[model samples]
Target: MDRFPEAFKRFEKVVAVEEIETFMQLRLAFGSWAGRKWVPTERQIEALNVEAARLRLEGAWRRETIVVRGKPHVRYRDVRTGRFIEKPF
Candidate 1:
C-alpha cells in the first residue's frame, strides 16, 4: 500500500500566494503600531488569524535546507553550465 496519497490532496482552506504576501505586509504594518493600546479591528484580527493558520499548514510542507561543507545545497544545478550537476564534495 502506498503510504502517500494516490492523488494530490487539495486543501479546503487554501490561501492564495498574493493573500499571504498581503498578510505579511499587514503584520509588518501592525507591528510598527504594536505599542498602541487600541486593539486591532475585528477584520484585521480575523485576517491575521487566518494567515497564521495558513502559514502553519504551508510551513509543514516546506522543503528543508541542509548545509554541507559550509555550502547550502538543494538541487544539483550547475551555475556556469546551466545543467544539472551531481553534488561534489
Candidate 2:
C-alpha cells in the first residue's frame, strides 16, 4: 500500500507524505475526484501496517529533553497538543 491515497498518483508528481504540509492541500488535491469505496487486500493490509509504523516515527513522536535530579532525560512532545509526553507509548 502506498503511504498516500491511490488518488494522489493521478498528479504529475508524487510527493513524500512528509512534504505535505497541510490537510487542506491533501483534500483539495484528492478529494474532489470522488469514486467508489473499496476494501484493502490482505497484502495491502500488511503494507499498511508497515506504513503506519513509518508514519508513527515521522509524526506521532517528537523528541525533547528534560532534567531530573541533575540528569537529562529524553522525552517526546505530542505534536497536536504541544505538551511533553515524557515517554511515548
Candidate 3:
C-alpha cells in the first residue's frame, strides 16, 4: 500500500477497500441490505446464525479474528498449533 500508484493517481482513480470490507462483514453477519434497510436472505442468515451458535456452543470462538491482509498477502492462524502466520490476503 505504501508504494506509490503513479498511473492510478494520474487517472484520478481510488479503490474502496474499506467500504467493500465493511460491506462484506455486514452482509456475512446480517445477510444483505437494500433500500436503506436490512433485507434478510433466509439461507445466508440461517447459515450465519447456525455457525455462530455452533462456535459459541462449542467454545471455539474465543480466538482472535485477525485483520487479514489484502491482495497478494494472507494473514491467519495455524489452527492445530494456534500460531499466527502471515502469507498474504
lDDT preference between candidates 1 and 3, better one: 1
For model 1, the local distance difference test gives 0.39
Better of 2 and 3 by TM-score: 2
RMSD over all Cα atoms, model 1: 14.4
lDDT of 2 by residue, 1-89 (tens): 45443544443245455654443343333333323332445443333334434444333435567899999988767555567765533
Model 2 error, position 55 (Å): 12
lDDT of 3 by residue, 46-69 (tens): 333333333332211112344436
- Clash pairs, candidate 2, are none
lDDT of model 3 at residue 84? Answer: 63
Q: What is the clash count of model 3? A: 4
lDDT value for model 2: 0.46
Whole-model lDDT per candidate? 0.39, 0.46, 0.34
Winning model by TM-score: 2
Q: Please provide TM-scores, in order, for all candidate models, with all chains considered together.
A: 0.24, 0.32, 0.21
Model 2, TM vs. native? 0.32
